[model samples]
Target: MAARRASHAGSWYSDEAKHLGKQLDNWLSAADLCHGPARAIIAPHAGYQYCGACSGFAYRQISPVVVRRVFILGPSHHVRLSGCALSTFTKYRTPLYDLRIDAQVYRELEATGHFEWMNMSVDEDEHSIEMHLPFIARVMENFKDSFTIVPVLVGSLTPDKEGLYGRIFSRYLADPQNLFIISSDFCHWGHRFRYTYYDRSWGEIYQSIRNLDKMGMDIIETLNPSGFTDYLKKYGNTICGRHPIGVLLQTVHSLQKSGNNGHKVSLKFLKYAQSSQCCSLSDSSVSYAAAALTFE
Candidate 1:
């Protein structure tokens, strides 16, 4: 099978190996390492200049975990589909290296009857999962054999479909070898994003956006899928990856119900930031955040 090429390389991040390597190394170096392993992580899927550093904070925590298989759940910005689409490509190409796709796991998942094996072209330009590869490749070099990924793109769907997919994927979480990476960016404030409500004043819009993100983060920290959905129902926080995150929480909650203790599953807030702090203009800003799900 033909591999999906890096479509967002130069624009979103470095296209050259040396430059990309150095850039990623810098981000990883700057982050403070977490004490333990992370079963899952929620990171930003924006341009490097905007959210790369914030993503680094979460990836740093993932670096310690020596898992052979990673399950990546990212929001689909371009496509709209029910359930989740798993990439059928043999590998995902990147400047750093072409990371292999976990074909065995992909086949197993396909056998389960939940995910549709998407055409390679469907994932060509999607940055959500592609953006995280270089970081994983850079930080996870300790693996003797290059780790493979199972990339799943989640889209808008009915609540029943959401819960169905959630329960489907939760079955795999029983294995400690399977790591889940949820790609998401927090809030898109200001007029450019058409999410404006508050004024453009730095202090006001900044604080308001941060407060909104914190509310969402509080729900995530609780690891309560229903609470997060309620927050979304009450006030639609513009979290781009809300669906994927919801699936993750639902998966965790499902495990909790089936004799898997909930106390062992918890979240750790890593970092949060505004796009204005990076380089975006003040009139419009997108918030970014990083967190890890630890199952002790």
Candidate 2:
């Protein structure tokens, strides 16, 4: 079976297994597991130096032993896809280990008639989904062979389409054995990004950016997809993975509508950081946030 190589490794992150493992271990150890045994997580997908440590707060919540399948939903940065796509490869090669894709789940999703297949070139070129493989491999290392992955490359979906896909995946979200990882990075600020929303009332430019992101994060914690949509429409925050995050919100909303076994579900933001504080309009920086969704 063909495997997707860790093409971004050695540059985006370390290629050496020992060094990468140690880095993940240190970050995971530093993060406090406050809202864990996560049913799902929303974490950043930037390079390790930029968002890796911040992402640990999300991964640290996983009860790896209980999870048998991981569903990774990430945005498409390089490709212009109108709908969601699934991986064609059987395995994904990370520095630590190769993660097997769940063929059974792929078959089921394909049967839905709503998914598309991504060829090897498109799969290898996208970094949003690839960035999370090493972390998943490390967190589930002990039971690595016991679990399989489902990687979904979400496209520029309309809110209606997001709900459609959400309803399609709601069953898996209800399964305690499944875990969802939503890859996203919040707010790209600066002239280079062509977005410089500044409110002097927030004191500084970076503070304004923080306030803007916090507003969006708060909406996500409410588990209201429309609310998130409204926030995005209003501020136009440069959240690269807004489509994937919308799908996750819609999934939770669908589960709630179905009563979801009467279980209470809550999503909380655990960590937030910026690559650099944007002090001027000419400066550029990307925001990273880590959140966990728990079912109680």
Candidate 3:
């Protein structure tokens, strides 16, 4: 079977299995399982040095024994896509181990006729999906052979398209044995990113960014996709994975609407951090947040 190489392994993270495994174990060990046994998670996809520790808060919540499949939905950074695309490779190689792609789930999604197939080059070039592979491998190591993954590259989509894909994935989301991992980073602030919105009342520039991101996070926790859309429009926050996040919100909404109201699903953010503190207009910083979606 063909495999997609861990393209960013050496630079973004360690390529050696032993060293990388130890690093990930330290991060996971440091995190407390506040809201656990997550059905889904929203975690950052930056390099190990930047978001690795923050991502632990989200991954630590997983109950690996029960999971049979992992659905990774990440933004398409290199290619322009109007809808979602699935990986053609049978497996994704990581420093830790190779993760098998669920061909059965792929065929089922393909039968829906709404998804697209990503070529090997595009699949390998994208870092958003690949960054989560190591963490997924670490968190589910004991049950490694039992679970297969479905990686979906989400494109820039309209609100209607988000709802469409959300409805398509809702059936899989309903299954307790399936885990959804939404890859995203929060606000990208400063002139380099061409965004410099700061409220002086918030005291420091980073403080302002935190408050701004907090507002959006609060809205996301409510599971209101329209509200999130409005927040994006109002602030124009450079949330690269907004579309994927929107799709997850709509998935929960779709589930609740489809008579799954009795099964309560709640999303809560556990950690937040920035690459740097943007104290001035010239400084740039990328925010990272970790959240868990749990069913009560």
Candidate 4:
């Protein structure tokens, strides 16, 4: 069965591939105001019930051109790796299907100074990356050619280092047939999030996250590396894959500067809703949101 594991089935998303695909399909079908086919995106990887709609927005904008590969740079939710972790798993089990990892690509990056193999904690039962499977599957169901994937879980990337990496990886990333995905979610507000008593709709939670997201989005729009880090630090943002976003921004800017930034590179606000907004009338609160990025 090509070494595989059902890390988040039945919990983070669903155990039935069809059902999961339907859920994502429903969200994408109704999305509007999205832009071109993007090579990369910053998506939230939380339980489907919460952020699925928001994440769907990003998936909805993807137009699989000649993409032969997908690189999901996820966050470290359950396990931690030295620099970044590259999974040796030949197949990553999801409800829709067990997608194969491009082993040779993994090795190629490993050969490069930018990549490294992870130890025991490289990948555990984490939904940060897995939650996105059905999404990609739904989008690429019609892809004519086989697709490859490289899952990179990044913890922290310094501002200066991110810039250097951007410069170094520009040419490496200029290839038009690859897609980059940054797995992340916005601010984790309140007690439910260990930030405070997120269980209750306290004073003003939306205000806080929106205030923070504004800063984060600005950095993305401006393609500013330092601005990204400064904003993240100032608010002590809880974006799980902050470092991954740093790498992505650097990588995106590198491509733009090199004159190969693609046809339609853009950031779109797909979905945004706090957990409190969705909690049952009788229940308390939670933080949740979804957004998508696309390139044409």
lDDT of each: 0.82, 0.95, 0.95, 0.68
What C-alpha lDDT does candidate 4 achieve relative to the native structure?
A: 0.68
Q: Which scores higher on lDDT, 1 or 2? A: 2
* TM-scores, each model vs. reference: 0.92, 0.99, 0.99, 0.85
- List where candidate 3 sits over 4 angstroms from the true fold: none
- Model 2: lDDT to the true structure: 0.95
lDDT for 262 (candidate 4): 53
Whole-model lDDT, model 1: 0.82
Tell me the tens digit of each residue's lDDT in model 3 across 1-296.
Answer: 89999999999999999999999999999999999789999999999899999999999999998899999999999999999999989999998889999999999999999999999999999999999999999999998999999999999999999999989999899999999999999999987888999999998999999999999999999999999999999999888889999999999999999986577789999999999998888899999999999999
The residue-level lDDT of candidate 3 at 55 comes to 97
lDDT of 1 by residue, 260-295 (tens): 655588788789999873223447778999998888
Candidate 3 total steric clashes: 0
lDDT accuracy of residue 15 in candidate 3:
99
- Residues 171-205 of candidate 4 have per-residue lDDT tens digits of 64567677777787777655555543222333354
C-alpha lDDT (0 to 100) for residue 234 of candidate 1: 73
True-vs-predicted CA distance for residue 174, candidate 3, Å: 0.5
In the range 1-296, model 2's lDDT, one tens digit per residue, is 89889999999999999999999999999999899899999999899999999999999999999999999999998889889999999999999999999999999999999999998899999999999999999999999889999999999999999999999999999999999999999999988888998989998899999999999999999989999999999999999999999999999889889886488899999999999998877899999999999999
